[model samples]
Target: MSIGVEEAYETAGMILFHNFDIRAVTLGVNLKDLIHPEAEKMCAAVEERLTRLGTRLVRQAQAVSGELGVPIINKRISITPAAWLIEPCPSPQAPLLLAQAINRAALAADVDFVGGFGALMHKASTQADRRLLESLPEALSRTQRLCAFANLASTSAGMNMDAVNQVARLLKEMAAASPDALACAKFVAFANAPEDNPFMAGAFHGPGEADACLNVGISGPGVVRAVVDKYPDCDLTMLSEIIRRTVFKITRAGEMVGRKLASLLGVSFGVVDISLAPTTAIGDSVGMILHGMGLERPGAPGTTAALALLIDAVKRGGAFASGNVGGLSGTFIPVSEDTAMIEAVECGALSLEKLEAMTAVCSVGLDMFAVPGDTPAHALAGIIADELAIGMVNNKTTGVRVIPAPGRQPGDCVDFGGLLGKAPVMRVSRFSGSNFVGRGGRMPAPIGALRN
Candidate 1:
């Protein structure tokens, strides 16, 4: 990965002054080879492997961050899907024990989050997959650093309404077991989920991947917003060109850092996900980028078009930067994590329905938004089904990370603090989808999937 000298100097300025940083450097370690029939030994071996790899991951990430004078905000680890490892051991306690072991390993290594603690049931759930689903509420409620995901739908296999309904009830259970429904923040439901994504709550080492590798997620909504703000009167074509140029710089920086870190750790370099993920900080917002693009606020009349243009420009820039770009390489519009999005919801400029439409174009689906506590499980399933359908039909990766805040009503706010941030409870449709969701069968894949 090579960068021009002038481009490097400009990127360094963005890092030194602007709020540009590598969001995460995730080590994907395959646990398939370590599976054991003895539950006790399996758990111990998993813990030991994670602890050893995670510690080196953190140390090397920090060293790289210091060397480059750019901050790497998080060092994370993702393992093979827990259900695959737990299948060999039929013990009922296997899921919980494995989750506990993962939590311990994350803590021991001082890593922020450990992912891939769930299963893939895009078509159907096996006995072990069902067991893992049943244990999720307890496992997520008990563990702090462990994150989980379930890919209930995909373009090829269509939607698994049964697993979708199951995840809804499990999320409700997890919310009831935790204060402020924090556990729900750690879970994601996906359609067309990526195996090598380095982002949290959705990353996993796919069965087809190598033994171990390194992937990077780079974020710079602030940097892009700053550039867009500077060219206030630029035309739409010029605006896109500006965004593409800025994102190219961001992706190049990520490529450089990811390669250096992978070399130091003696692991193959995976991909750089140049997603413009936002935070609670004021300037760091994908919504603000849209605001700069001439939208008064997100979810306004032209919000979807703005987001589509932004995502397209970002992807083009990333492709220009590196051939290895993978993952959900576009703009992420998680409501709670972006101040502009939170304000949009508070002011009624954004609605759940509008967010569903936006998901058709954005990188991920209805992420980090909260709905009413009284929202029924089938209603949650309805929401998931709608979002997943978008991904399945469009052939893109989309996910839902919604929280049902306990005892909260529409307009009520739940403060999760830190990176999870605060979210205003958004209103859901009063009409129930129980009847539709109760029709528990696979929704067939779209015609698009038949291509090739």
Candidate 2:
């Protein structure tokens, strides 16, 4: 985490001119030790622990941000998946109760978000998981700060079509319960989900991690794009080298900030997630980076090739910069959060089909996009199944955060404001894959999974 003088100067320039910032400093806290047989007792224990730790995390993250002159956008907390803690409770309300407690603690502590209201159901689910899944509509629609995720597929365990089906049905219910379908924005479905992701709504303290750790998610799409803009006339290979170098510096700066914050909080420092997450600010966009790489816009022909090159260079640079790089450390194309992406959809340059093709090369899939409200539950299931299959077969982490904007039509828009940003409603195919995804069975692991 040592920052040389030269690197410091470069990072200062990045911060001052290019919107380089730490997107989130998420403190992952293991809650396995706090589980209790009674729902009230368990909820009480979680509330007490999270309130104290979350307060400290928010305070220290602010201090570190000011002390280093770097912006830390969101102070967040990730806990052990809530379903495991409620396994002993017989009450059907256990999940909702726990979610309320966590939400209260997050509000008390003044953190931006609290993630891990989720379960690992890549293959199958327990009774507790089923109970939690059923309560998602209530929990997500009711809580402002609590985020939820379900790992429905993985390379080794294959795809959990049953859980996928359940989540798709729950999503529609969640949309019905919340305005603008905002509840769906807080819930993501994943395949090969990362254990230590610092980004929501998919972050959780994996069962294998330490009791507490601090993970940092870095953002520098603007900085990288600025660098890419300078190499317009250069060939793709050289452009990649330059982008790689810029990300190397960005990752190093993020590691320095993360390690200092972790030390201040008296927790172990986890990985630096070098994902180029974008925002609505001008020039702060992964899609703009692609445009700078010579695409007319994202979703144009050759856009996938440009994205593939960009992400590969990003990974190589981050891996070179630090040994502790983890999470989904690649490019994020969340349509709502990136202005260029939103424009691409508005101009009809980006379609759902093209976005799907791009996801095969990017970090996550179908993030923060919107579709018409009348999209059938089975159609949503078909969409999730398609993305999850990409991750399952490719052995990469992919997720979906789609909003079925209730009563909205294609070409309409929904504004969630702040970092959730605005999204244009994209058209969904009228053709249904109901019979295909309705087959409730596991899609078997790939031949690559049999390597072990």
Regions of model 1 farther than 4 Å from truth: 1-9
lDDT of 1: 0.92
lDDT at position 367, candidate 1:
95
Residue-by-residue lDDT tens digits, candidate 2, 275-394 = 889999989999999999999989999999999999999998999999999988968899999999999999999999999999999978889999999999999999999999999999
Off by over 4 Å in 2: 1-9
- Per-residue C-alpha lDDT of model 1 across residues 136-189, encoded as one tens digit per residue: 888999999999999999999999999999999998999998889999999999
Worst 10 residues of 1 by lDDT: 9-18
